[model samples]
Target chain A: MSSKITWPVPDPAAPPEAHPALVSAALSAARAYGEARAEHTRGELAESSRTGADGTATMRVDELVEGAIADTARRHRVNLLSEEVGFVDNASALTMVVDPVDGSNNAASGVPLSCFAGVMVEDGVPTEALTCWLDTGRCWHAIVGEDTAYRTSGRTELDGAALGLLRPHPEIGRSWWHLAERAERVRVLGTTCLEAALVAEGSFDAFVDPGNDAHRIVDLAAALVMVPAAGGVVRDVFDRPLEIDTDLTRRWSGVVAATPELAERIIETVRG
Target chain B: MSSKITWPVPDPAAPPEAHPALVSAALSAARAYGEARAEHTRGELAESSRTGADGTATMRVDELVEGAIADTARRHRVNLLSEEVGFVDNASALTMVVDPVDGSNNAASGVPLSCFAGVMVEDGVPTEALTCWLDTGRCWHAIVGEDTAYRTSGRTELDGAALGLLRPHPEIGRSWWHLAERAERVRVLGTTCLEAALVAEGSFDAFVDPGNDAHRIVDLAAALVMVPAAGGVVRDVFDRPLEIDTDLTRRWSGVVAATPELAERIIETVRG
Candidate 1:
């Protein structure tokens, strides 16, 4: 596939809003990239031979998407913070945090549950966020100073709550098991951004990353804007604010819940 | 929404095999029904006012899909066995096991992870199966006497395997926790048929339903054909054959794994 793919450019007739235009560019780039590579067989896409800047093995499709997203970000004149390439300074105050493809394994294996996420941060605060499902072209967005379109389910209790968890590894196994015991349902869908979007839209009561710092800044930036806009709370496991530097090296464990009450209950239970 | 929605009929020029045509009819009906109800607001679809034949609260979308499926099965001359509206004998030797909407809660809440599943059984043995993802019109099918289109990942060990589980409830909590401890990853995506299909297509290594007889015949019938065709194994927790009566009153706890070795290990670990 050609590195330069054609996508719908932002309309000049629209109002001159930097954040919305940045989000539109990201969405168009992701959709175009996904369509270009969707025809590859699973075996072809699952080949992982290179190490990404995030310290994980990168698949062929991941690199392709990262390149596409980087081109789009540069065209939009936004600084880039991404998983594969880390932080790329464009000498601009507006930084677009991007996970070119979250749940790369799912995408390579044709699971249809992965997504692309971009959050435009201005002056160390996320002002706009957009996440698009790679398989379906469905997009969700939230802006800081606008009316929220989606809200949480307002389910405050742990019992009978629908929840999503990051996959369990040794470091976080016990914590994941504890949370699983308390949650009415636990889904580890393998995509952090999409799971967070599900919580923001009330489809899931909460999404928790147990104890391991498994998530990076690129993964949580979109959720940080979306959950708050949806009347939900996103916080670390210790109940601290989920703040992080715009770098891939740092990791955090946190919960995105439909309500503050539910977030608190999750913290207490998981800590125990 | 009108009950008489128009869907694309199967082409008459296609082969007239009973099983393939039956699957085609089911796919067309499900797509049509999903499109008809896709425009409803989440709140509207989430309204559950009546009890279903399975003793759960029924959503409006479930009723709509079930009616459409029933109509299709009648036109195809296959006897119906479904979760909602129970068994409707059409006096035919072939039985179509249908879960009109497998992940009803996800569908109602706009989660985009739900699916429609149907299995054609002859003399208590599943001969053909079809699963259609409602959100995306992707479909997977298998025939007993034909070449299978999908295959498993061939991961024989559990250490780094991608696993899926049914949500933990009181009756099955201990088994679920045990399995969670042993597996590398666990996802409770809330749709049994789709998860099984994921395993069949090499996305997940295995899928387990711990206990409490959480699944009905309508859910596993499709997986029965698909998993085996994909060179995977599906068996009960006690290592018995996964055969069951064609009625909805009975339930089973089972494991669908990419390999026989993994399936056996899961049974031993969860049973302990």
Candidate 2:
């Protein structure tokens, strides 16, 4: 007996500098999220994963948003590699890698902190990225090897620096406490893509997954391009190389930080 | 070389069903916050507590918003009790208690999760309350003993419930881990009032302070009236009576839940 989250989703204010395909994809994702909110209650959206009458899995909000992005890819005539759909071939060297809804649980649960994260990869190299805050319609765009409109906090230490983290993994609870104790401030925003955007924009000094190994390629693709463009660095806690891959099964503990020194510090602490 | 958080603060969408004073105060807070964002950079706003050349503490984003709220109280001719500015007497029986900006750090940091929370009290009884998420302009309003438009999730167990929490305090970190481990999902959104509103509306199963005793009267003031109207209960972990009080020095560990049984379960788990 609950109502749906009724907040209106505004249009994406994508920067004029962003790629046309990325901008179009973000708009499509926003529309799909809005439509879902309008038609379904929070409970209904949360229950979209049940078996259908035909014994097939029902589409959740994530799949619905991904479907919209797929339509955008079709119009743009680019290949798509997304979390839910895996890969859709378009006979093009350029691929649009995306996490249609970054925090699918948050999106379905009516939390306003989800994101649309996409990167344009040319023959396995990410050339540009766009990440949009779906609720507020704010967008951040970045191209490889180019200066961005924003910069990181440039913080080099963990003490007195604001930190963002994924929720603790029960198996690694000590490491969670270790980093939380060292940081002067900590936030767990429940969305890795949005938290990474905050780090790129200097709102947060760093965002990390403390030994969780919970992020897929779709989760870190956009941050890999955007954070470095803004003078920050995105790394895996285990020192694994981050690249655009079509393997949806790969996972990493992504760390998006204001500076390389701080990223190393976080990795070391979590590992210790 | 970081930029200010440039997101616009929309006008509060205060429900027509609320007391005029609460709505007016929320509007004033939003306006003041917007003005501060337009006029100052994030680093400058973050350093607002410095002693000025005139030997006075500088006006912070928090103070600016509170000043505007005070002006609204003046216009309404009601007594005001707030966090930053302790209390203002208007020779009237009615008082407006507010946390001018609930997530002050989140506000100045441009995290887009801060809120304006206000409660209208008559002779120390909170008769009505209003909460506005400053980022999205969505609002929740409720009068004591009146049914609200939304209802809680009615979750009776913590095993699979989604939970929101305040950041961890080092001294009491075990309690934080205890609750986080038991919950099926956890989020630390860094804003108590907004998180409480999520619990009230069934977006989150519960929001708790985890024995930190970090909640001031202004933080939980709006939740006391709003959640109960929406079929939830807001309580203190230590079982302290919550009421309208002018003493800003007092604190409580707040537990806001969808049902009475769930509230008790959380309190017992945290206390253990």
Candidate 3:
């Protein structure tokens, strides 16, 4: 069963500056939550079979991570919107959207692509975001209009430009053909959250997930904060502006997030 | 243009323990070659998009990796059978099969799903093997019938159980759908060599690649030795034994590497 979350829309008159100290505290909390869950994920993956229908072990890891985040949110006295456990703490100065494990399925099989995502919302707008790639020990963080950075062993901001693209559903089969025709060296990584984080670092130009309705909010919430903070845009398939307050629990079918120019070019390529 | 490699037929009468240290030296040489190439794979991936229609950059990385392995084989005074460069030092005491970087495409995409594979042959029979997942810093190794152990950040041993399935290609549609119907969670990490190593570790039930024809002896060579050494079975989809000596440069149409029983089962699943 699914449920809707209600949020108090921030007033336009509310001050836009969210506390940087609070953002720092949130980042630390997110990192701790991610570290604790990493051990559980490793053990679960080790004991689990790849082909079994019972993904209980995987779910248990997700639940534990979610619980840890929720506990931390309560301790921090922050409202939380989490993928595993929905919204909590209705009225608070800050709101956190958490995805305990973004690539749950991949983590279950010991695939090295899973991550933990967190985004902070202030006054009904995303203010800060962070993500940690579990296996790689890579972390990315962004504060809107302030700074965006990626860190593994040390801190640095990505400078190279890589484009992200979304192929329309109608173009799925023919898309590769078109890619071949355009001589585009494209890669489909299959994890939406990871792609979005890449967009924030300016390492990737765009991210296109045609059906937003299919993926859970845990994947997109952090991306929502990161992309715009890095000067990228996220929109619907028909190229309509996205509303942050929309019910995020459901999939957003046909979404594209990219640099303005690249997004337009990708849409044009698909249309052609 | 494509070429074929010739390998010596295994001589059952030859001493099994012959030239163990030579195999070790060859393995070490292979590792050095792989490590060198891995250092540059990231840069290659960063530059893949800028490559022209002729795929000069892709070919360049392949040639560079292949060249290093050939040089290493020369230095070690061992015969070499490699994926990109084919055969060298044909009549030496130790014949090393090497894949400098498996998952070339993934390595070219910053996917971290690539590895180096090496197998040592004596009298045409694989005697020892080493496979290293470059990104994770995990290595799986086996020397003849001695216990096979996997070395990662944490150490683990294959229980002689579990199947590791590779990519199961559908005759049609997305090659991924084959995994959807299974009771087990399907994992596609995008690197053929790494998947093969997982089979060697007994961490997975089987590895199946139905439609892709990129499985070369050099790619599977190292994993094949480790898997069989760990008491697992490895074979092609036709239930035929994977012949490591056959034209090493050519790729197989489909492969199923697992316990003998699991391999048969997966083949049936593909056929059904």
Candidate 4:
């Protein structure tokens, strides 16, 4: 099965340790889940009557995808840590951090800016990551040791930089807007994984969260691997390393940027 | 030519005076231009060496699209009011308010949330409007007397409504976040026409601007027609009517909502 999985190596120097078959299984599961759900209307899919394993309101689509992904992971003998089903312990050493659907509101509302992401972690470190955009069916992935498929824009200034921001809670809205006002363009696309990918691919110079524990481990898992692999910086708001335990309840306020300088500038702007 | 263009009657009551052929020609032009530009990368398309007709930095893709739109308007014998080329007088009663490439920054940076919008105004009142999502090629249109193709979500409360917000400047950032904090979700997709269309189609409950002169005639022209046709309310922040002159220099702070109740709630939230 490991031999059957083909991973593209953009950087020949860095090959990942997690078996490619595990990543392939996750991607195939996500694609299958997304395709099935795409046929339904937002109205049919958006009912939040049930609570997820993570304690947030769960939609029908969430349960559907989570079930499909968990089935795939079990078949591949990989452990799963996901939003809807919490952590499913398996026999293998590798754990897949997954968000069956990120930006549920956007997906439920037909906003076309949601995605499915899964990151393979081995021995407490993420080895490989994959993000599949649900609307466009475009997928981006990176292994920590491989050459990144994309590069950051190398933009160091905020004056005219394209920035992506997540929606802020009332307590942090002011702080969020302070940083937003300094940038030439600010977009809040309502999806963290896709927004982080935009920064990694240079579509956006940065993707910042106004200081609140708004993002969970599942949300930032793929970004933690993809951003650094693409020559971008992913850090917490306080300049702390953006590592968290595999606990589903743990949350982080993240800032993913094209460069370290831009990341520091964002930190200063929000703190100041 | 006018006889050849058949406008679909979503509303049997609305018999627009503007010829359907004019609207068809404009839509075709936008589609053609978008398809041509979609082949290039964001890096290749995002050069800002030349200034646009509106005194903002212009990209080569913008010029290409704007020229194509202008030529189409000229061929159709419609007067033009646009962001790129300003006003072009023609020997026709119908003036097409156009944003050749709305969300230019999004397009240039490959954000996939940009559009082309054209509204046919006779005697300063918008009669027919068309908005084409550039990335997806999905188009929404409405004539004043016709039945609307979509409806708003009719959510009156901000607590859990899907809100679309424009990025606010420093002067208005506080006011913007004040309203943003109350909403269940806030999205800043960076294109006025498409955002407004989302509101009109029930995908978003409301689309608001933080109190500043952020939007121009070209931005709101299509919304002014589409929102009302879809049974939504559009008004300025001051509770004034959202009517603007044909002058490209003029600007307004606007809000489009699924209901008058929601619009009033947003206005009160911002002002308070």
Candidate 5:
């Protein structure tokens, strides 16, 4: 109500030993988004102020949060690859790929479902990831080579499965409905990184894009490292590699599932 | 996740002067659900423990949370009407109708989108309502006739509107698709009360069930009071009165919209 979010945004609970770039970016993103809400109305926040390098209209809320994160990346001396601002090259092997405010619409609309997701990539290989829910500072961090604090649901079948999915589009609505029909429970949470985190934490059997080609590299950066570490699979429906390409316009339909079997099943189902 | 939600369920931020019965029930529900997550694996928590009074399979997490709320109702000397336990007659004029854990599947599965929603009704009239998000303990409380701290989005047109909705079912899939096609944004969060609370707080333009009669009194108890107080209208698709019916089996397709025009448009769209 009143064109503003009344509740205060909480500080992110980034764990100890998280990459300094990720931690700083998450904190800066949260604080900037919070201040954006306090100062701007919903209309202002949701306004498409400029075209992002990703070939999409960037919302003011996304800009504010991304601006803060870009500053953090510069301070940390890491190359930044983000949704709104594209890549800020520092010519370093270490890169921070992030969705500064995932679920930008939810963030501007005060839906309390937005997140800050970032991954540490070393020489085109993802090393670690962190995802923080902005409304409440719940963090899920995982290193690619190390054990995770979480686990997947270990589900292998589409039947009796619980899934988080993207909303349907006219072109891809069938894919959405098909997976939803097979699953016993379905949720469209409007935040990809958070949904992937839920799958990593064994909350849902999978988080899928359903052939929508809705995810950019920044969108899946965290899931690319985190899900596999948590005993799950991160895949593209068309079997494309999730490479760290600087082309922000490239898209993928990401499927983050609890098990390799389940991920394969989802891919086959989408293909059908 | 090891079958446990590692994050602590926060204490509810219920406003001062909230009804004692509602406050107690919310606190108890959050605590019990948190404890259930700690003790049970996702499978154990999600097991269809029993048939609820609402003619549906109840999860163990729901039972645990409802059990706690039922005890709180008895201590508060109020009649209790909950989904799992049905109605408990305390022979009092005041009745606390509650969905102890609104999103049972999400709660049990650790999706962190469930809530505790309760409405205090006096002689068939809902006097006040409270919705507490279990994972974050954020509360939205509103008195039927009093001014509220929040406001609705005040949107009228379905086109360019944002909505929170129930997931599509085969029987009502067309209706779900129809409104989704018109809306600018769509989310299926799997929790009616929390979606309705978002509608009340201006985070979303509407929360709809399409033509699926998925809501019992307890599912919509809080929205019936809170949404209207925040300048919105709550209606059933079939135009049935949201009366204080003792029959837990009775269902309605709830349409909680930010404005009467938007509510009417949604009903027409579903009907078409």
Candidate 6:
């Protein structure tokens, strides 16, 4: 399907305030891209006849989403690091690490927890992030200093905090162990991007996904911008500062999330 | 907060048609009742905090919800069976089992996965059921004669035919072994009642809650109506038909649900 969004040329002179807008635009573009990916995945699922042999394989949705992200970045002349196809368009100081679709496997299986996520960073500092649920048409955004947040229906606050976790892969034993110990009431909603957004809404105390499935940078780009802006925290599993750079592109399992206390505790639990 | 909803009234003498009005009324009433339960839960959590406990116990929500259900049912003159308290108004032909707050621990601990559920059974057969989410204000309903069904944000589908299951608890190796053997995608969303509603929506294949925590007849009532209406199936681990009776109260050891074939397979696998 055609999209109405036009890519604006990145002007180095442009004020940083436009960063969130850029992130939002990229997310909207990614939603269409994700839908196309879903359609392709639907066909693939039908052809595969329910054998999950392809579970670990790279998805067609990935390619479609990456293409969308790359096109948007190239038009805006911003650097991009996308999960599906990797890095591209490195002319501007501002960069975006995109997950064309988080929870691609769930999307392929017709689970409703899949989405498109894009995070923008300026000079290595996260400035904005956007996540869009492809099927539900719901979008969430976090922009530094702008104080903007959104939520879908059914959102609630308990103990004055909302925290969500994506599927805690078996590898994140520390995370689960910590949760079991704390038993502070949590949710594993199965979507990383959405979990991060939920953190932004203060609907959750934190959102933690420590699996090394992707580089910390990809998850961080979104978490860094959203968590802090929402008056929460984000950090690595070690409770150390998370810095963005080329090293993050490769897979490294670590905690990525909201609330420093939650992060530190998770790191300690996992380390033990 | 006081509510205007009249409860415990006689069933519509003319046999209420499946019109949107009846559904709306049921939903609104359920919502009001659910809120009362939630408020009580909040108080319980606070009490737990004062006692230096982490507030994971579901006892408070259970009592509050049961009370609300009774008051509401009394207004409607409907029969009721609740998880916390036992049967009330049992002489009525159409007995209503009300799981005042499904996923009580989750609700008590600030997790948004819990919900309020009820089912209307005539002569031991479910004729109608309603589920209301206290946090999100979303409601679902199912009526007899058409199999079970419900609504979610304008989406409608059958239960169990599209099943969802909680990952088997390690303690219960049999259930997971069974699910893996059948290649069923087992999930643990941590809320049995919500899982049951998804069965009505066909969003999941079935739902399994091995830790029967709040396994009261009232807890399964609404889901029972919806699942059957949607052409899905649910059963205890032994492959016995799921019944709404006092036996299920707080039994949390294991449970299984799915389409007839899948449910049967899961039962056999666990039985072995």
CA lDDT scores, all candidates in order? 0.74, 0.87, 0.51, 0.74, 0.91, 0.52
* Pairs of residues clashing in candidate 1: none
Question: For model 2, how does the per-residue alpha-carbon lDDT over B1-272 read when each residue is reduced to its tens digit?
Answer: 64787778899999777788888899999988999899988876666665422223444887889889999999999999988778899888999999888887888888888999999999989999899999888888889988988888889898788899889889778888888888878888888999999998888999999888888889999999989999999999999998777887788999999999989989999989
Candidate 5 chain B lDDT trough over 10 residues, lowest sum: B1-10
Reference-based lDDT, residue B5, model 6: 16
Deviation of model 6 at A35, angstroms: 5.7
Label model 5 with its docking quality class: medium
TM-score of each: 0.85, 0.95, 0.68, 0.84, 0.98, 0.69
Go through the candidates in order and give each one's DockQ: 0.37, 0.64, 0.07, 0.30, 0.70, 0.11
Q: Residue B127 of model 4: what lDDT?
A: 85
Q: Distance (Å) between predicted and true CA of A239, model 4? A: 5.0
RMSD of 4: 8.6
lDDT of 3 by residue, B125-215 (tens): 8887766665445556677778754321121212232223343322333432343344244444556677766655433555666645546
Off by over 4 Å in 5: none
* Model 6: how far residue A249 lies from native, Å: 5.0
lDDT of 2: 0.87
- Report the Cα RMSD per candidate: 5.5, 3.3, 11.3, 8.6, 1.2, 9.1
lDDT of 1 by residue, B1-272 (tens): 11111112221121235366455655655655556455666657667788877767888778877887788878878888888788888888888888888888777766677778888887677888888777666677788867675678887887666788887665776777777777766677889889998888887889988866777777888889889898898888865556646556667787889999988888887888
**For residues A1-272, could you state the per-residue lDDT of candidate 6 as single tens digits?**
11111112111122234465355545545565545543453435223222111123456655555566677787778888765455565678878867766766555544455666777877777776776665444556677777653322122222233345544444555555345445344555666676666555544556655543443456556766766676556665544456665543344444443455555655565566
Candidate 6 has a TM-score of 0.69
Q: What lDDT would candidate 5 get against the real structure? A: 0.91
Model 5 lDDT per residue over B5-45, tens place? 77778778888799998998999988898788888887788
| Residue B199 displacement (Å), model 3 | 3.9
The number of clashing residue pairs in model 3 is 35
Q: What share of the true interface contacts does candidate 1 keep?
A: 0.59
For candidate 4 chain B, the 10 contiguous residues with the lowest summed lDDT are B1-10
List model 2 lDDT by residue over A1-272, tens digit each.
65788778888899888888899999999999999899888767766555422223445787778889999999999999988778899988889999888877788888888999999999999999999999889888899999987899899998788899898888778888888999888888889999999999899999999988888888899899999998999999999998777777788999999999999999999889
Is model 4 an incorrect, acceptable, medium or high docking prediction? acceptable
